[model samples]
Target: MALWTLFGLRQGSATTRWPAPGGDDGQADVLGMPRYHPERCGDGCSACADACPTGAIVADAAGGLEVDYSRCIACQLCVEACPDGAMTASGDWAFGVRRREDLRWAESGDPPASPAPTAGYRRSLHIRHVDAGSCNGCESELQALNNPIYNLHRLGIFFTPSPRFADLLLVTGPVTNAMIEPLKAAYEAMPEPRWVMATGTCAVSGALTGGGYAAQQGLGDILPVDVWLPGCPPNPAAIIEALLMFLDRMPQRVRGGQYGE
Candidate 1:
Protein backbone atom coordinates (compact mmCIF):
# COMPACT_ATOMS: atom_id res chain seq x y z
CA MET A 1 0.00 0.00 0.00
CA ALA A 2 2.82 2.38 0.85
CA LEU A 3 4.60 1.66 -2.43
CA TRP A 4 1.35 2.23 -4.31
CA THR A 5 0.83 5.49 -2.42
CA LEU A 6 4.26 6.68 -3.55
CA PHE A 7 3.45 5.73 -7.10
CA GLY A 8 0.13 7.58 -6.85
CA LEU A 9 1.90 10.67 -5.57
CA ARG A 10 4.39 10.43 -8.41
CA GLN A 11 1.52 10.29 -10.89
CA GLY A 12 0.08 13.44 -9.34
CA SER A 13 -3.27 14.83 -10.53
CA ALA A 14 -4.52 14.03 -13.99
CA THR A 15 -7.74 15.95 -13.40
CA THR A 16 -8.81 18.14 -16.31
CA ARG A 17 -9.78 21.71 -15.52
CA TRP A 18 -12.73 21.98 -17.85
CA PRO A 19 -15.72 24.37 -17.63
CA ALA A 20 -13.03 26.86 -16.71
CA PRO A 21 -11.07 28.47 -19.54
CA GLY A 22 -7.49 27.27 -19.06
CA GLY A 23 -6.83 23.60 -18.26
CA ASP A 24 -6.92 20.70 -20.73
CA ASP A 25 -10.62 19.92 -21.12
CA GLY A 26 -9.99 17.07 -23.55
CA GLN A 27 -11.90 18.85 -26.37
CA ALA A 28 -8.93 19.15 -28.72
CA ASP A 29 -9.48 17.37 -32.08
CA VAL A 30 -12.75 15.94 -30.80
CA LEU A 31 -15.29 15.35 -33.59
CA GLY A 32 -18.15 17.45 -32.33
CA MET A 33 -21.74 17.98 -33.41
CA PRO A 34 -22.36 19.05 -37.03
CA ARG A 35 -23.05 22.59 -38.21
CA TYR A 36 -25.51 23.80 -40.82
CA HIS A 37 -25.37 26.72 -43.22
CA PRO A 38 -28.64 26.91 -45.10
CA GLU A 39 -27.31 29.46 -47.56
CA ARG A 40 -24.56 27.06 -48.59
CA CYS A 41 -27.00 24.25 -49.33
CA GLY A 42 -27.79 23.67 -52.98
CA ASP A 43 -31.22 24.88 -54.07
CA GLY A 44 -32.65 21.37 -54.34
CA CYS A 45 -30.02 19.28 -52.60
CA SER A 46 -31.22 16.42 -50.44
CA ALA A 47 -28.03 14.43 -50.26
CA CYS A 48 -27.36 15.08 -46.60
CA ALA A 49 -30.84 13.89 -45.69
CA ASP A 50 -30.54 10.77 -47.78
CA ALA A 51 -27.17 9.82 -46.36
CA CYS A 52 -28.19 10.16 -42.71
CA PRO A 53 -28.51 6.65 -41.33
CA THR A 54 -30.92 7.71 -38.57
CA GLY A 55 -33.18 9.89 -40.71
CA ALA A 56 -32.21 12.85 -38.61
CA ILE A 57 -32.28 15.03 -41.69
CA VAL A 58 -35.24 15.43 -44.07
CA ALA A 59 -35.84 17.55 -47.11
CA ASP A 60 -37.67 20.70 -46.18
CA ALA A 61 -39.44 22.75 -48.80
CA ALA A 62 -38.95 25.82 -46.67
CA GLY A 63 -35.51 25.38 -45.02
CA GLY A 64 -34.10 23.20 -47.86
CA LEU A 65 -33.28 20.62 -45.18
CA GLU A 66 -34.70 19.97 -41.78
CA VAL A 67 -32.36 18.45 -39.21
CA ASP A 68 -33.42 16.67 -36.06
CA TYR A 69 -30.48 16.42 -33.70
CA SER A 70 -32.24 14.05 -31.33
CA ARG A 71 -32.02 11.23 -33.87
CA CYS A 72 -28.55 12.23 -35.10
CA ILE A 73 -25.79 9.70 -34.42
CA ALA A 74 -23.05 12.10 -35.56
CA CYS A 75 -21.81 9.54 -38.15
CA GLN A 76 -20.90 12.51 -40.45
CA LEU A 77 -22.36 10.68 -43.43
CA CYS A 78 -24.38 13.79 -44.20
CA VAL A 79 -21.19 15.80 -44.26
CA GLU A 80 -19.55 13.38 -46.70
CA ALA A 81 -22.65 13.12 -48.87
CA CYS A 82 -23.21 16.84 -49.29
CA PRO A 83 -21.86 18.26 -52.55
CA ASP A 84 -22.26 21.74 -51.15
CA GLY A 85 -20.72 23.17 -47.99
CA ALA A 86 -23.99 23.46 -46.06
CA MET A 87 -23.14 20.83 -43.50
CA THR A 88 -19.66 21.09 -42.04
CA ALA A 89 -18.03 19.57 -38.94
CA SER A 90 -18.15 21.96 -36.02
CA GLY A 91 -16.54 22.30 -32.61
CA ASP A 92 -19.69 21.84 -30.63
CA TRP A 93 -19.82 18.76 -28.44
CA ALA A 94 -21.98 20.41 -25.81
CA PHE A 95 -25.39 19.88 -27.37
CA GLY A 96 -27.42 19.74 -24.17
CA VAL A 97 -30.76 21.41 -24.79
CA ARG A 98 -33.49 22.48 -22.41
CA ARG A 99 -36.25 22.26 -25.00
CA ARG A 100 -36.77 19.38 -27.43
CA GLU A 101 -37.93 21.54 -30.34
CA ASP A 102 -34.49 23.11 -30.34
CA LEU A 103 -33.23 19.91 -31.92
CA ARG A 104 -35.03 20.59 -35.17
CA TRP A 105 -34.04 22.97 -37.98
CA ALA A 106 -36.17 24.44 -40.74
CA GLU A 107 -35.41 27.47 -42.93
CA SER A 108 -38.10 29.28 -41.00
CA GLY A 109 -37.07 27.59 -37.79
CA ASP A 110 -36.49 30.33 -35.29
CA PRO A 111 -33.53 30.04 -32.98
CA PRO A 112 -34.41 28.25 -29.76
CA ALA A 113 -34.32 30.84 -27.06
CA SER A 114 -32.46 29.87 -23.93
CA PRO A 115 -34.62 29.18 -20.92
CA ALA A 116 -33.68 30.02 -17.39
CA PRO A 117 -32.88 27.22 -14.98
CA THR A 118 -36.26 26.28 -13.55
CA ALA A 119 -35.20 23.55 -11.13
CA GLY A 120 -33.68 26.00 -8.67
CA TYR A 121 -30.43 24.06 -8.88
CA ARG A 122 -28.27 27.04 -7.94
CA ARG A 123 -25.11 25.22 -6.89
CA SER A 124 -23.82 21.66 -7.03
CA LEU A 125 -25.87 18.76 -8.39
CA HIS A 126 -26.22 15.12 -7.42
CA ILE A 127 -27.24 12.84 -10.26
CA ARG A 128 -29.18 9.59 -10.23
CA HIS A 129 -28.47 7.47 -13.31
CA VAL A 130 -30.88 4.86 -14.71
CA ASP A 131 -30.28 2.60 -17.66
CA ALA A 132 -33.52 1.45 -19.25
CA GLY A 133 -32.10 -0.71 -22.05
CA SER A 134 -28.69 0.48 -23.05
CA CYS A 135 -26.11 -1.56 -24.97
CA ASN A 136 -23.47 -0.42 -22.37
CA GLY A 137 -21.60 2.11 -24.50
CA CYS A 138 -23.11 5.03 -22.60
CA GLU A 139 -22.25 3.39 -19.31
CA SER A 140 -18.60 3.12 -20.28
CA GLU A 141 -18.37 6.89 -20.75
CA LEU A 142 -20.25 7.53 -17.52
CA GLN A 143 -17.67 5.45 -15.71
CA ALA A 144 -14.95 7.80 -16.95
CA LEU A 145 -16.56 10.73 -15.18
CA ASN A 146 -15.25 9.38 -11.87
CA ASN A 147 -11.71 8.69 -13.03
CA PRO A 148 -8.78 10.80 -11.89
CA ILE A 149 -8.56 12.52 -15.26
CA TYR A 150 -12.08 13.89 -15.27
CA ASN A 151 -12.54 14.23 -11.51
CA LEU A 152 -16.15 15.30 -11.88
CA HIS A 153 -16.36 15.93 -8.16
CA ARG A 154 -14.26 19.05 -8.57
CA LEU A 155 -17.10 20.64 -10.52
CA GLY A 156 -19.52 20.00 -7.67
CA ILE A 157 -21.21 17.08 -9.37
CA PHE A 158 -21.74 13.69 -7.81
CA PHE A 159 -23.48 10.44 -8.60
CA THR A 160 -25.72 8.99 -5.93
CA PRO A 161 -27.31 5.56 -5.80
CA SER A 162 -30.63 6.74 -4.41
CA PRO A 163 -32.93 9.09 -6.24
CA ARG A 164 -34.13 10.54 -2.96
CA PHE A 165 -30.81 12.33 -2.53
CA ALA A 166 -30.36 13.28 -6.15
CA ASP A 167 -31.19 16.59 -7.78
CA LEU A 168 -30.88 15.34 -11.35
CA LEU A 169 -31.95 12.13 -13.06
CA LEU A 170 -29.47 11.35 -15.85
CA VAL A 171 -30.90 8.58 -17.96
CA THR A 172 -29.36 6.58 -20.82
CA GLY A 173 -30.92 4.09 -23.29
CA PRO A 174 -34.42 3.43 -24.53
CA VAL A 175 -37.18 3.12 -21.95
CA THR A 176 -37.97 -0.55 -21.85
CA ASN A 177 -41.46 -1.41 -20.62
CA ALA A 178 -40.10 -3.47 -17.74
CA MET A 179 -38.04 -0.54 -16.48
CA ILE A 180 -40.68 2.14 -17.05
CA GLU A 181 -42.52 1.57 -13.80
CA PRO A 182 -39.31 1.44 -11.81
CA LEU A 183 -38.04 4.56 -13.50
CA LYS A 184 -41.20 6.45 -12.68
CA ALA A 185 -41.04 5.24 -9.11
CA ALA A 186 -37.54 6.59 -8.79
CA TYR A 187 -38.64 9.97 -10.14
CA GLU A 188 -41.58 10.08 -7.78
CA ALA A 189 -39.25 9.41 -4.86
CA MET A 190 -37.07 12.37 -5.65
CA PRO A 191 -37.90 15.69 -4.01
CA GLU A 192 -39.31 18.58 -5.98
CA PRO A 193 -37.03 20.80 -8.07
CA ARG A 194 -35.57 17.66 -9.60
CA TRP A 195 -34.36 17.64 -13.21
CA VAL A 196 -34.11 14.95 -15.88
CA MET A 197 -31.42 14.73 -18.58
CA ALA A 198 -31.54 12.35 -21.54
CA THR A 199 -27.86 11.62 -22.11
CA GLY A 200 -27.51 9.81 -25.46
CA THR A 201 -29.17 9.07 -28.81
CA CYS A 202 -30.94 6.07 -27.33
CA ALA A 203 -32.35 8.06 -24.44
CA VAL A 204 -33.31 11.04 -26.61
CA SER A 205 -34.99 9.40 -29.64
CA GLY A 206 -34.92 5.65 -28.86
CA ALA A 207 -32.86 5.09 -32.07
CA LEU A 208 -34.08 3.01 -35.02
CA THR A 209 -34.17 -0.38 -33.27
CA GLY A 210 -35.95 0.87 -30.12
CA GLY A 211 -39.60 1.09 -31.16
CA GLY A 212 -40.88 -2.32 -30.06
CA TYR A 213 -43.57 -3.01 -27.47
CA ALA A 214 -40.96 -4.29 -25.01
CA ALA A 215 -39.24 -0.93 -25.19
CA GLN A 216 -41.14 2.33 -25.01
CA GLN A 217 -39.78 5.28 -26.99
CA GLY A 218 -37.26 7.55 -25.30
CA LEU A 219 -36.99 9.28 -21.92
CA GLY A 220 -39.18 12.15 -23.14
CA ASP A 221 -41.96 9.68 -23.93
CA ILE A 222 -41.95 8.49 -20.34
CA LEU A 223 -40.97 11.51 -18.27
CA PRO A 224 -40.24 15.19 -18.64
CA VAL A 225 -36.71 15.89 -19.84
CA ASP A 226 -35.04 19.12 -18.85
CA VAL A 227 -32.03 18.47 -21.06
CA TRP A 228 -31.51 16.48 -24.28
CA LEU A 229 -27.99 15.35 -25.28
CA PRO A 230 -27.74 13.16 -28.37
CA GLY A 231 -24.80 11.08 -29.50
CA CYS A 232 -24.29 7.37 -30.26
CA PRO A 233 -22.69 7.73 -26.87
CA PRO A 234 -21.29 11.17 -26.11
CA ASN A 235 -17.63 11.10 -25.11
CA PRO A 236 -16.59 11.77 -21.51
CA ALA A 237 -15.84 15.45 -22.19
CA ALA A 238 -19.19 15.94 -23.89
CA ILE A 239 -20.93 14.35 -20.92
CA ILE A 240 -19.30 16.76 -18.52
CA GLU A 241 -20.16 19.71 -20.75
CA ALA A 242 -23.78 18.52 -20.94
CA LEU A 243 -24.01 18.34 -17.16
CA LEU A 244 -22.47 21.77 -16.78
CA MET A 245 -24.79 23.10 -19.47
CA PHE A 246 -27.73 21.81 -17.47
CA LEU A 247 -26.49 23.74 -14.46
CA ASP A 248 -26.33 26.89 -16.63
CA ARG A 249 -22.60 27.07 -16.15
CA MET A 250 -21.89 26.75 -19.88
CA PRO A 251 -23.47 28.21 -22.98
CA GLN A 252 -25.44 25.83 -25.20
CA ARG A 253 -23.55 25.07 -28.41
CA VAL A 254 -26.53 23.76 -30.33
CA ARG A 255 -29.60 25.67 -31.44
CA GLY A 256 -32.09 24.39 -33.97
CA GLY A 257 -29.98 21.21 -34.45
CA GLN A 258 -27.07 23.26 -35.82
CA TYR A 259 -23.95 24.31 -33.99
CA GLY A 260 -22.63 27.87 -33.59
CA GLU A 261 -24.37 31.20 -33.67
Candidate 2:
Protein backbone atom coordinates (compact mmCIF):
# COMPACT_ATOMS: atom_id res chain seq x y z
CA MET A 1 0.00 0.00 0.00
CA ALA A 2 2.79 2.46 0.80
CA LEU A 3 4.57 1.66 -2.45
CA TRP A 4 1.35 2.23 -4.38
CA THR A 5 0.79 5.53 -2.60
CA LEU A 6 4.34 6.62 -3.47
CA PHE A 7 3.68 5.75 -7.12
CA GLY A 8 0.43 7.69 -7.02
CA LEU A 9 2.13 10.80 -5.59
CA ARG A 10 4.80 10.58 -8.29
CA GLN A 11 2.10 10.40 -10.94
CA GLY A 12 0.63 13.57 -9.35
CA SER A 13 -2.61 15.08 -10.63
CA ALA A 14 -3.14 13.70 -14.11
CA THR A 15 -6.59 15.17 -14.44
CA THR A 16 -7.02 17.85 -17.06
CA ARG A 17 -8.18 21.39 -16.27
CA TRP A 18 -9.63 21.77 -19.75
CA PRO A 19 -12.74 23.88 -20.37
CA ALA A 20 -11.08 26.04 -17.73
CA PRO A 21 -8.36 27.60 -19.88
CA GLY A 22 -4.59 26.94 -19.95
CA GLY A 23 -5.13 23.24 -20.52
CA ASP A 24 -4.29 21.23 -23.61
CA ASP A 25 -6.22 17.99 -23.59
CA GLY A 26 -5.34 15.05 -25.83
CA GLN A 27 -7.80 16.07 -28.59
CA ALA A 28 -5.93 19.19 -29.68
CA ASP A 29 -4.00 17.33 -32.38
CA VAL A 30 -6.56 14.66 -33.12
CA LEU A 31 -8.57 14.83 -36.34
CA GLY A 32 -12.13 15.64 -35.45
CA MET A 33 -15.11 16.11 -37.80
CA PRO A 34 -14.39 17.07 -41.40
CA ARG A 35 -15.33 20.54 -42.53
CA TYR A 36 -16.87 21.17 -45.96
CA HIS A 37 -16.68 24.23 -48.16
CA PRO A 38 -19.52 23.62 -50.57
CA GLU A 39 -18.56 26.59 -52.73
CA ARG A 40 -15.20 24.95 -53.46
CA CYS A 41 -16.83 21.73 -54.69
CA GLY A 42 -17.11 20.91 -58.36
CA ASP A 43 -20.30 21.83 -60.18
CA GLY A 44 -21.69 18.31 -60.02
CA CYS A 45 -19.11 16.45 -58.00
CA SER A 46 -20.30 13.50 -55.95
CA ALA A 47 -16.94 12.19 -54.84
CA CYS A 48 -17.31 12.92 -51.14
CA ALA A 49 -20.81 11.53 -51.11
CA ASP A 50 -19.65 8.34 -52.77
CA ALA A 51 -16.82 7.82 -50.33
CA CYS A 52 -18.97 8.13 -47.21
CA PRO A 53 -19.61 4.59 -45.94
CA THR A 54 -22.64 5.82 -44.08
CA GLY A 55 -25.18 7.98 -45.91
CA ALA A 56 -23.75 11.03 -44.20
CA ILE A 57 -22.81 12.81 -47.41
CA VAL A 58 -25.82 12.39 -49.65
CA ALA A 59 -26.48 14.56 -52.68
CA ASP A 60 -29.53 16.75 -52.46
CA ALA A 61 -32.03 16.99 -55.29
CA ALA A 62 -30.50 20.33 -56.30
CA GLY A 63 -27.12 18.60 -56.82
CA GLY A 64 -25.60 20.08 -53.66
CA LEU A 65 -23.78 18.04 -51.05
CA GLU A 66 -25.80 17.43 -47.92
CA VAL A 67 -23.46 16.61 -45.07
CA ASP A 68 -25.14 15.31 -41.96
CA TYR A 69 -22.87 15.59 -38.94
CA SER A 70 -24.88 13.00 -37.04
CA ARG A 71 -24.15 10.11 -39.41
CA CYS A 72 -20.55 11.06 -39.97
CA ILE A 73 -18.00 8.80 -38.24
CA ALA A 74 -14.91 10.95 -38.95
CA CYS A 75 -13.69 8.26 -41.35
CA GLN A 76 -11.99 11.06 -43.40
CA LEU A 77 -12.79 9.11 -46.60
CA CYS A 78 -14.84 12.07 -47.79
CA VAL A 79 -11.81 14.33 -47.40
CA GLU A 80 -9.61 12.04 -49.46
CA ALA A 81 -12.35 11.39 -51.97
CA CYS A 82 -13.12 15.01 -52.78
CA PRO A 83 -11.43 15.98 -56.02
CA ASP A 84 -11.82 19.65 -55.22
CA GLY A 85 -10.66 21.37 -52.02
CA ALA A 86 -14.21 21.46 -50.67
CA MET A 87 -13.71 18.97 -47.90
CA THR A 88 -10.83 19.57 -45.52
CA ALA A 89 -9.68 17.82 -42.36
CA SER A 90 -10.40 19.74 -39.17
CA GLY A 91 -9.82 19.57 -35.40
CA ASP A 92 -13.39 20.52 -34.54
CA TRP A 93 -14.37 17.75 -32.13
CA ALA A 94 -17.04 19.50 -30.05
CA PHE A 95 -20.22 18.40 -31.92
CA GLY A 96 -22.89 18.47 -29.21
CA VAL A 97 -26.14 20.32 -29.94
CA ARG A 98 -29.49 21.01 -28.34
CA ARG A 99 -31.42 20.43 -31.55
CA ARG A 100 -31.23 17.55 -34.00
CA GLU A 101 -31.37 19.93 -36.99
CA ASP A 102 -28.11 21.42 -35.73
CA LEU A 103 -26.40 18.24 -36.84
CA ARG A 104 -27.01 19.16 -40.48
CA TRP A 105 -24.36 21.31 -42.10
CA ALA A 106 -26.80 23.56 -43.94
CA GLU A 107 -29.30 23.86 -41.11
CA SER A 108 -26.97 24.22 -38.12
CA GLY A 109 -26.79 27.50 -36.28
CA ASP A 110 -24.89 28.76 -33.24
CA PRO A 111 -26.28 27.68 -29.91
CA PRO A 112 -28.68 30.10 -28.33
CA ALA A 113 -26.76 33.04 -26.85
CA SER A 114 -27.52 32.07 -23.31
CA PRO A 115 -25.39 30.40 -20.69
CA ALA A 116 -28.42 29.42 -18.72
CA PRO A 117 -28.01 25.89 -17.53
CA THR A 118 -30.67 23.24 -17.70
CA ALA A 119 -33.01 24.11 -14.83
CA GLY A 120 -32.45 21.24 -12.44
CA TYR A 121 -28.97 20.13 -13.40
CA ARG A 122 -26.98 23.34 -13.44
CA ARG A 123 -24.40 22.20 -10.92
CA SER A 124 -24.56 18.41 -10.94
CA LEU A 125 -25.72 15.97 -13.61
CA HIS A 126 -26.53 12.31 -13.37
CA ILE A 127 -26.74 10.23 -16.52
CA ARG A 128 -28.32 6.89 -17.29
CA HIS A 129 -26.91 5.10 -20.33
CA VAL A 130 -28.84 2.69 -22.53
CA ASP A 131 -27.40 0.69 -25.41
CA ALA A 132 -30.30 -0.09 -27.69
CA GLY A 133 -28.16 -1.75 -30.37
CA SER A 134 -24.82 0.02 -30.57
CA CYS A 135 -21.61 -1.28 -32.13
CA ASN A 136 -19.80 -0.42 -28.82
CA GLY A 137 -17.33 2.19 -30.01
CA CYS A 138 -19.30 4.84 -28.14
CA GLU A 139 -19.29 2.67 -25.05
CA SER A 140 -15.53 2.53 -25.11
CA GLU A 141 -15.32 6.33 -25.17
CA LEU A 142 -17.88 6.63 -22.40
CA GLN A 143 -15.74 4.48 -20.16
CA ALA A 144 -12.82 6.86 -20.69
CA LEU A 145 -14.68 9.57 -18.82
CA ASN A 146 -13.72 7.79 -15.60
CA ASN A 147 -10.03 7.61 -16.43
CA PRO A 148 -7.53 9.74 -14.53
CA ILE A 149 -7.11 12.14 -17.45
CA TYR A 150 -10.74 13.16 -17.88
CA ASN A 151 -11.85 12.66 -14.26
CA LEU A 152 -15.53 13.19 -15.04
CA HIS A 153 -16.42 12.68 -11.41
CA ARG A 154 -14.69 15.91 -10.47
CA LEU A 155 -17.34 17.80 -12.40
CA GLY A 156 -20.09 16.38 -10.25
CA ILE A 157 -21.43 14.20 -13.06
CA PHE A 158 -21.97 10.54 -12.39
CA PHE A 159 -23.35 7.56 -14.30
CA THR A 160 -26.07 6.04 -12.21
CA PRO A 161 -26.80 2.37 -12.72
CA SER A 162 -30.52 2.95 -12.51
CA PRO A 163 -32.66 5.27 -14.60
CA ARG A 164 -35.00 6.03 -11.75
CA PHE A 165 -32.32 8.16 -10.12
CA ALA A 166 -30.97 9.75 -13.27
CA ASP A 167 -31.56 13.22 -14.61
CA LEU A 168 -30.60 12.42 -18.17
CA LEU A 169 -30.72 9.39 -20.43
CA LEU A 170 -27.50 9.12 -22.42
CA VAL A 171 -28.39 6.66 -25.12
CA THR A 172 -26.21 4.92 -27.67
CA GLY A 173 -26.91 2.38 -30.44
CA PRO A 174 -29.40 2.43 -33.32
CA VAL A 175 -32.58 1.90 -31.32
CA THR A 176 -33.11 -1.63 -32.49
CA ASN A 177 -36.65 -2.97 -32.64
CA ALA A 178 -35.89 -5.33 -29.80
CA MET A 179 -34.72 -2.46 -27.58
CA ILE A 180 -37.23 0.31 -28.22
CA GLU A 181 -39.56 -0.69 -25.42
CA PRO A 182 -36.70 -1.09 -23.00
CA LEU A 183 -35.31 2.28 -24.00
CA LYS A 184 -38.64 3.96 -23.49
CA ALA A 185 -39.10 2.19 -20.23
CA ALA A 186 -35.76 3.45 -19.08
CA TYR A 187 -36.64 6.99 -20.07
CA GLU A 188 -39.92 6.73 -18.22
CA ALA A 189 -38.08 5.49 -15.21
CA MET A 190 -35.98 8.63 -15.04
CA PRO A 191 -37.24 11.33 -12.71
CA GLU A 192 -39.32 14.24 -13.95
CA PRO A 193 -37.57 17.15 -15.64
CA ARG A 194 -35.47 14.42 -17.16
CA TRP A 195 -33.68 14.95 -20.46
CA VAL A 196 -32.40 12.62 -23.17
CA MET A 197 -29.05 12.82 -24.95
CA ALA A 198 -28.32 11.03 -28.21
CA THR A 199 -24.71 10.00 -27.90
CA GLY A 200 -22.95 8.70 -31.03
CA THR A 201 -23.73 8.76 -34.74
CA CYS A 202 -25.82 5.63 -34.60
CA ALA A 203 -28.18 6.94 -31.93
CA VAL A 204 -28.43 10.42 -33.42
CA SER A 205 -28.86 9.49 -37.07
CA GLY A 206 -29.19 5.70 -36.91
CA ALA A 207 -25.98 5.18 -38.94
CA LEU A 208 -26.23 2.07 -41.11
CA THR A 209 -29.17 0.57 -39.33
CA GLY A 210 -31.63 3.38 -39.78
CA GLY A 211 -34.94 2.96 -41.60
CA GLY A 212 -34.74 -0.80 -41.25
CA TYR A 213 -37.94 -2.80 -40.93
CA ALA A 214 -37.18 -3.84 -37.36
CA ALA A 215 -35.51 -0.74 -35.84
CA GLN A 216 -36.13 2.94 -35.25
CA GLN A 217 -34.96 5.78 -37.45
CA GLY A 218 -33.05 7.49 -34.63
CA LEU A 219 -33.40 8.46 -30.98
CA GLY A 220 -34.95 11.84 -31.79
CA ASP A 221 -37.49 10.17 -34.08
CA ILE A 222 -38.67 8.10 -31.14
CA LEU A 223 -38.02 10.37 -28.15
CA PRO A 224 -37.66 14.07 -27.51
CA VAL A 225 -33.93 14.65 -27.24
CA ASP A 226 -32.42 17.54 -25.31
CA VAL A 227 -28.89 17.12 -26.61
CA TRP A 228 -27.24 15.41 -29.57
CA LEU A 229 -23.55 14.38 -29.34
CA PRO A 230 -22.66 12.81 -32.69
CA GLY A 231 -19.63 10.88 -33.82
CA CYS A 232 -18.86 7.30 -34.88
CA PRO A 233 -18.02 7.41 -31.21
CA PRO A 234 -17.14 10.85 -29.95
CA ASN A 235 -13.70 10.95 -28.36
CA PRO A 236 -13.39 11.10 -24.57
CA ALA A 237 -12.55 14.82 -24.53
CA ALA A 238 -15.40 15.57 -26.90
CA ILE A 239 -17.83 13.68 -24.68
CA ILE A 240 -16.64 15.58 -21.60
CA GLU A 241 -16.98 18.91 -23.37
CA ALA A 242 -20.51 18.06 -24.47
CA LEU A 243 -21.59 17.13 -20.99
CA LEU A 244 -20.08 20.31 -19.56
CA MET A 245 -21.75 22.39 -22.21
CA PHE A 246 -25.08 20.84 -21.27
CA LEU A 247 -24.33 21.62 -17.64
CA ASP A 248 -23.52 25.25 -18.58
CA ARG A 249 -19.94 24.85 -17.45
CA MET A 250 -18.72 25.81 -20.91
CA PRO A 251 -19.94 27.48 -24.06
CA GLN A 252 -21.13 25.49 -27.07
CA ARG A 253 -18.48 25.43 -29.75
CA VAL A 254 -20.55 23.94 -32.55
CA ARG A 255 -23.21 25.73 -34.52
CA GLY A 256 -24.77 24.22 -37.59
CA GLY A 257 -22.07 21.50 -37.42
CA GLN A 258 -19.32 24.06 -37.73
CA TYR A 259 -16.78 24.49 -34.92
CA GLY A 260 -16.28 28.07 -33.86
CA GLU A 261 -14.65 30.27 -31.22
Error of 1 at 234 (Å): 1.3
My TM-score estimates for the predictions, one after another, are: 0.90, 0.93
**Model 2: number of backbone collisions:** 2
lDDT of 1 at 15: 81
> Looking at candidate 1, what is the lDDT of residue 235?
88
Candidate 1: pairs in clash:
63-107
Give the count of colliding residue pairs in each prediction: 1, 2
Residue-by-residue lDDT tens digits, candidate 2, 1-261 = 699899999999988887578876778778988998988989889999999988889988898988889898899999999989799999888888777667788544564554434844554788999998888999999999999888888889999999999988999998999998999899888888888889998898888887789778779878888888988789988888888778776777777767786
- lDDT tens digits, residues 154-260, model 1? 88899999999999899899888888999999999999888899989889998765788788668887898888988888888889888877887877767666565
CA lDDT scores, all candidates in order: 0.83, 0.85
lDDT of 1 at 255: 69
Candidate 2: residue 83 Cα off by (Å) = 0.9
Worst 10 residues of 1 by lDDT: 112-121
Off by over 4 Å in 2: 107-117
Location of the lowest summed lDDT over 10 successive residues in candidate 2: 108-117
Whole-model lDDT, model 1: 0.83
